[model samples]
Target: MAHETFLKEIGGKSVVEQIVDNITNAIINGELKPGDKIPTENELCASMGVGRNSVREAIKILGAYGVINIKRAEGTFVTQDYDSKMLFPVLYGIILQKDSANQIVELRKIIDVGILQLVIEKLDSESLYKVEQAMKDLETKITTFNVKAKDIFEADIAFHMVLVDITQNALLEGICFYVDQITRTSRMKAIEKFLTEDATEQFLLMHKEMLRVLKEKNKNEINKVVENHYQYWEKVNS
Candidate 1:
């Protein structure tokens, strides 16, 4: 909330970016709580020694991400349900970078292993049925050799998402949502490689075994499936 803090151009970043960073930081640090009205456009421009256009553009960007809500005649307030949606651009950029490709696979491997037990514990018969169907459909799509890679990729995500949804954890769901989203392009490419260079039928069998292990309630089997699946995806990524 210090005007002087905004005045000092400590880096070569754009004025608009700087303002957006400062406001987001303030929200993160609890300096600006949810539902708190932010300073007006005029006040912000004057205090930061920036043009009205800069402030307006920055605010507009924030609004688009659901970080702030602007109500005519009321004012702009920090969103009550604000989460990492505001950081989508930054997160998506990092995830899609060529250098970050392997790291993305590694991240998924970690989350996949971590969620197995939670999913096993909560999965009901209906969910199990749904998962079985999803895997079967994805198996057919991949094995048929006629489906587009993009369609296969989407089906693959949907298949995994059935298990992810079984956990009933909002945070887990949100992370998976964004991960599936920003990597859609690269995942399509990986599926093409998988379809051409990998054994689609064996992959389908492995998926069936995964379902079987879940149905049998076998911890050791689940651990083995997780390890094998991790390796399976690693090859697909290449």
Candidate 2:
């Protein structure tokens, strides 16, 4: 452990952030686990040899990242699950910069593609069944003959959320929360601009293709389907 070297150079929020980085590393490194209570503020202050304010700030920051959760009387504890709330600020910052919005969407597509590919082999019948159910829900919503544009948008969102849950990777699953928020906002705007029954049917068809590829365990085909699916939205939004 590079303990001394890490402690020597402390500046700005760098110091507080470093504390967070170290603690997160510890958790990932298995030095900490879910249900393990973090040290009290006083103990943390003493161990880190930092002021109570700095320790408190570090705790708050980590809390936001879903690394830890605070309980009123029980102190803080490591979370069993990753929370997407931590990524909101990053997403917000990206949104404010118009140039990065498209870039983030591209990044999101890449990550989503990777996650699906990674989990393809591990996908169980139960997970596949869930996907089928979501697909059916989407099909029903689209075939309602007089489906509102919002219904299609919501069905699309539900489909992807199901994909996230199927991944079985906490970190990857967490990204869905923030990415969906951004995607939903943009999709709603686009739908409002150009609402069409054709678009809804097109999306449903693409989802069907995606399900077919997953069932075949064809990674290349899966990627192609997903790429086309996202490209549809990109063309609309662009």
Candidate 3:
């Protein structure tokens, strides 16, 4: 395939950004496959009618975003696998947005509902056992007297992480991981609120309810169960 077909002339401000968009669009459109060597700096400049500096800046940005890799001797290539660096940009974007607290809650609800549905479809004995263990750990943390809110928060995160991981989907896991990071502060605050209100047991019960619902594998109950699980979180976050 001629790689030049992926290149197009730039016609707007921010030449570097337009170049980035062109290359990313090519990747998205399947013109550039994983491990495909992108056009060289000179070629990109010539094809896009941009200067070499703009091409270099666009390449640098793409490399930082983990969209492509630049080797010392080898040419730049599309990443072949999931990269953690890709999450930072998204995480920062959400954090910097106005009313991000509510936005994060909404995002979590959508992701959690989808994750539970996937887990229900793919739940196996081993995965169920792991998830059960996670719930048990959270329960223990909650029941312990004088336990720090941070400890409970860690256990809570672990339970959800297990749910996300059990699906055995790498992309979903990555997205969930970053979402978790984005909500870490709000979730920690929620835990503190629960501890202050002496509502830790209620929180524990919520996790139990989630596990019960998961075992039942009832699609109808997933949304309600997830909504209930986030009640305390939504309260503190809102």
Candidate 4:
């Protein structure tokens, strides 16, 4: 293939954006692969018919998005593994969307339900033990005298994360992790409400029900348990 074909001439109102699109298109089209060295700035500028400044700006954007890495002397290359930074754009988009609370709640419910099914199908003694331990930790945090809302909230996150981790699905894990981040403030508020209302036992019971559902592998009860799990969250967000 001609070197010029790797990044075609730019055509758009935004030179930097066009440059970014060209390079990303090359990647999606398999012209570029993980760890593959990107064309040099001069090469990109010439091929895309853009100025050095445009190429440099586009490269900076890509690097910030975790799509590529720049080594001082070794040159730039596509990232070889997942980077948490990649999720920032997605997190920002969801957060900025208007009337997103209902949508986020729906997304969470679907993900939680599907994840429960996956966990049940893939459950093993070791994973079960880890989940059990996570549950115990949450219980202890909630029952502790004068426990801070942050402590309870962290424990709650840890417990759910263990369940998500058990599936060993990287994509799913990333989605869940960011969704948790997006809802962090609202979740903390809900937790505070629970703590204030002395509803810690009720909150703890909901998790215990989740653990019970996991152990039983009762697909029939998955929906009910998940619905109950989100009631407080939905109420608080509403």
Query: Scored by CA lDDT, what does every candidate get?
Result: 0.77, 0.74, 0.88, 0.89
Q: Better model by lDDT, 2 or 4? A: 4
Among residues 3 or more apart in sequence or in different chains, the pairs in candidate 1 whose N, CA or C atoms overlap within 3 Å are none
- Model 3: runs farther than 4 Å from truth? 9-13
Per-residue lDDT tens digits for candidate 4, residues 105-214, read 88899999999999999999999999999999999999899999999989998998999999888878888888988888888988999988999999999999999999
Best by TM-score: 3
Quality of model 3 by C-alpha lDDT:
0.88
Output the better candidate (1/3) by TM-score. 3
Model 4: residues with Cα > 4 Å off, grouped in runs: 1-13
Once all C-alphas are superposed, what RMSD does model 4 give against the true structure?
2.4
Query: Ten consecutive residues with minimal summed lDDT in candidate 2?
Result: 1-10
lDDT of 1 by residue, 1-238 (tens): 6534434353789999988988887787787889988888888887778899999999999998889999999999999874657657756776767868678777777777767778788878899999989987887788674777777777788888898889987767778888787667666665666667665666567777778878987767776787676564566556
Model 2 lDDT per residue over 1-238, tens place: 3333223333565668768876777777777778788777776666667788887898988887677999998789988765777676677887788766577668777887886786687788999999999999988987887677788788877888788788777777777766777777677665544354356656677889888888888897766776777765676567
Which pairs clash in the backbone of model 2?
none
Give RMSD (Å) of candidate 1 vs. truth.
Answer: 3.8
Candidate 4 Cα lDDT to native: 0.89
Model 4 residue 194 CA deviation in Å: 2.0
Give the residue spans of candidate 2 off by over 4 A: 1-8, 11-15, 25-50, 69-81, 84-93, 96-98, 124-126, 190-194
